[model samples]
Target: MPVNMAEDGNVAPGLSAPIGGKKIFFVRHGKTEWNNQLRYQGATDIPLNAEGRLQARRAALRFSLAKVDAVISSPLSRAYETAEEIASFHKGAAVEKTSLLTEVDFGEWEGRTVAEIRENYAEIFEAWRVNQLNVDAPGGEKADDLYERCGELSKLLLARPERSIVVVGHGAMLRALFPRLLALPRVSYFWRTRIDNCSITAFGADAGRFVLLFQNDTTHLKVAEGRIASLPLL
Candidate 1:
């Protein structure tokens, strides 16, 4: 069983700190061509589109006022580029790439649109929607595998020296990891949670306990008008 760190309306005790807890700002990578097309891009390295770059710039402006100590990102180009934008605003803050932050592998589903998947793999899609934890994308990574990776990521983040940092990653991976971080059930994965491109989520650690301060905040991108594309469900 996965470790439960959070409870209903209460924070869990985890992620130890020497002096005090750290603040982690989690940001989904900027929009990609696949995102605009409503395609599953798991483990598919796609670069940010023009709108994505603009969104990253807006995010950078928002974080410019923040005391960001470091910027960490998935090895994928979209995530790495977004991290670069955030790091640009913070002097001496370099972007660190980690494979642990990569998107969940989609296997046969990679690069396929929702419509395509539904038309061909309707039953599989339904199975995934009903209980993603027990389903796999043909040959992709399973929910349990993702959960384990998320745990690894939690440990990696907790082991970081920086108190304030930014993490850029994919939608599916973030959604999968959120339950573990907040002590929610794996069955609740992706439930009522929407991770838009360049959206910001905040968390703080206190004496090893992780507290979710906010989730999927896009106030910074509101000024971008329609340039911010609609996020597709992958």
Candidate 2:
């Protein structure tokens, strides 16, 4: 059963029992140059850097042993490339793009560094940091807008015939959506919730509700890093 939207646009547990066991792996895309520079890349189509590629490869290796049924991604190149890496391990799996999965629109702040935003738009930035749900990015989107899209995405994933699905997307959007899916307070959404590049968060359907299995699991990357470090030098 798919989660339904409440009158307040929050996620509500479905009334009907789920037909079959279903799981969702929410994967954030690997790092990009913008990510390394701490730039606001909302809606900016930045490609992955060398380190990002390695991160994606490590993430791929992690999922290679899992029963991944489908790969869904944001249209952004960084996310799509990461999804491609995951799809490589799952033969016959196709990567599907969804606009709903795209990163939050940064508006005038896109491509700007946090420092720059703080220097130029301190009031707006501070307001957003304090209460993101109520504040809109200067000419960009508010938290509620992102929640609506994520709500749509939740429904789409629930409707899928596949039992196990991998959704690759951006950090901001994922962070924004996480609270809604868990029915947590919107104010508590981003605080202390780490959604690292190529990190995997998992959820499982139980009794017509989505239960969070884990959040920001990147142990596989640590193993991969150890393996790389252990390689003999030529």
Candidate 3:
């Protein structure tokens, strides 16, 4: 089972003093070319584009003053690049990559646009759009699979000794992880949540449970670029 998170208010930089618990900040990797093209990039190791690099820089600046003990990222280039940007600020913070943080495998649905998927696999696509839990991406993992991964990740995170950890990951995986951490209904929340690229979501660990500090925060992007309208809504 995944660790549950308690809902809370306005988030500050890192945890408040890092008293005795752990704080984990989740950052969605910057946009990729496929992201701009509205294509599914599940498990694809796409690199960040020019705009994405800039976004990553901005995200890094967002935590410049915070105390980051460690930075964990998906092995995918997009996420690793973003993690690099953030890790640059915290001089000694080690940036570690793990396959467990990789994006959900879209299988046959990978590298295709929603329209293309709908046109080709109409019934399955529509059913998935209506209720994601009812169907799986052709040959890909199901919600349970992703949820189990999230649970394993939670256990790993909780066991870590680091006080503040930054996790850079992909859209589908992060979306799946959030609901699982919050102990919410996965199917409903998964589709509804909008985890924009480079957005910052944070949580604090206490008493074997996590607390939601804030979620889907894009203040860094707005302040740095003032181009929130152009950002990808992954």
Give the C-alpha lDDT of model 2.
0.82
Q: Model 1, 172: alpha-carbon shift in Å?
A: 0.4
The C-alpha TM-scores of every prediction are 0.85, 0.85, 0.85
Write one digit per residue (lDDT tens) for candidate 3, span 36-138: 9999999978999998999999888888777889999999999999999999989899799988899989889999998899899899877776666446889
Better of 1 and 3 by TM-score: 1
Question: lDDT for every model?
Answer: 0.82, 0.82, 0.82
Model 2 superposed RMSD (Cα): 7.4
lDDT of 2 by residue, 1-234 (tens): 664533222254454333246888899999999999999999989999999999998888777777789999999999999999999989888999999999999899999999999999999898887767767898897667877887888777767878888999999889887766766765746555799999989877544457677788887677755454333211
Q: Lowest lDDT 10-mer window, candidate 1?
A: 225-234
After superposition, candidate 1 runs with Cα above 4 Å error: 1-20, 224-234
Error of 1 at 232 (Å): 27
